[model samples]
Target: MILFFGTRPGKPETKKLFHSICPYCQQQGALTAFTVKNYFHIFWIKLFKISSHTTIECSHCKRGFYDNEFTEEMKNELSK
Candidate 1:
């Protein structure tokens, strides 16, 4: 499916977006959180942040996915 961003042109939008489905349960959802790591001279620190978008958890398996991973294809048909 084609996705649009702002009402006008030259706006930021997503492209070539798609969702990742769970192989075991066939459930689809967005990414809710991610992990980040900071490296120092001799040590490394890890941090996790929750995403702004709502996360979808599988009812059966209780697995969660984040929205950031999903991609959308921006269409310029409106400008035509």
Candidate 2:
């Protein structure tokens, strides 16, 4: 899934604001690692797609959010 902000270009401030409100930004622990898996009829393979992923740690709440549903939703909205 891919999530994108619906804002005009050349507006860094707006982009920053949008990111701040993003669900992924609300997560903590910083995505230390990411894994991807592919299943086939005979076998399955699990590999590390990215060693490190962009992450945001909450300073006050100390919470973690690694949900990708937000991005999927954004993609769906854009398709419509």
Candidate 3:
């Protein structure tokens, strides 16, 4: 039996972080949040969502920040 089950990532939803500053570029309002959902797929068909990940990126410096690297302001804004 051939099993074609795997996980795939969904389209990332992005939102600009207002009043958020990027630590790498030191630029204000340059932070953007990206939320991506992973789903389990079988035979190229999506079955169920596995998990989701949130990442922050700096448009000025193009630096990526993970969950543990998020700043206080970033967390506050993302929560809303």
TM-score for each prediction?
Answer: 0.26, 0.22, 0.80
In model 3, which range of ten residues has the least summed lDDT? Answer: 17-26
Q: Number of the top candidate by lDDT?
A: 3
Q: What tens digits encode model 2's per-residue C-alpha lDDT throughout 48-73?
A: 22222222233345443353433543
Q: Kindly list the per-residue Cα lDDT of model 3 for residues 16-52, writing each as its tens digit.
A: 9979889888899989999999999999899999999
Ranking by TM-score, best first? Answer: 3, 1, 2
Count of backbone clashes, every candidate in sequence: 10, 1, 0
Candidate 1, residues 1-80, lDDT tens digits: the string is: 65333221121332221244544476454222232322222122223322222333444576654555332311121122
Q: How accurate locally is residue 4 in candidate 1, as Cα lDDT from 0 to 100?
A: 34
Best-to-worst lDDT order: 3, 1, 2
- Give RMSD to native, each candidate: 17.5, 15.8, 1.9
User: Model 2 TM-score?
Assistant: 0.22
- Which parts of model 1 have CA positions greater than 4 angstroms off? 1-18, 30-33, 41-60, 63-80
Model 2 scores what on Cα lDDT? Answer: 0.30
Q: Tell me which of candidates 1 and 2 scores higher on TM-score.
A: 1
User: What is each predicted model's overall lDDT from 0 to 1?
Assistant: 0.33, 0.30, 0.93
Clashing pairs in 1: 17-71, 17-72, 18-71, 30-65, 30-66, 30-67, 31-65, 31-66, 31-67, 32-66
- As for TM-score, the candidate ahead, 2 or 3, is 3
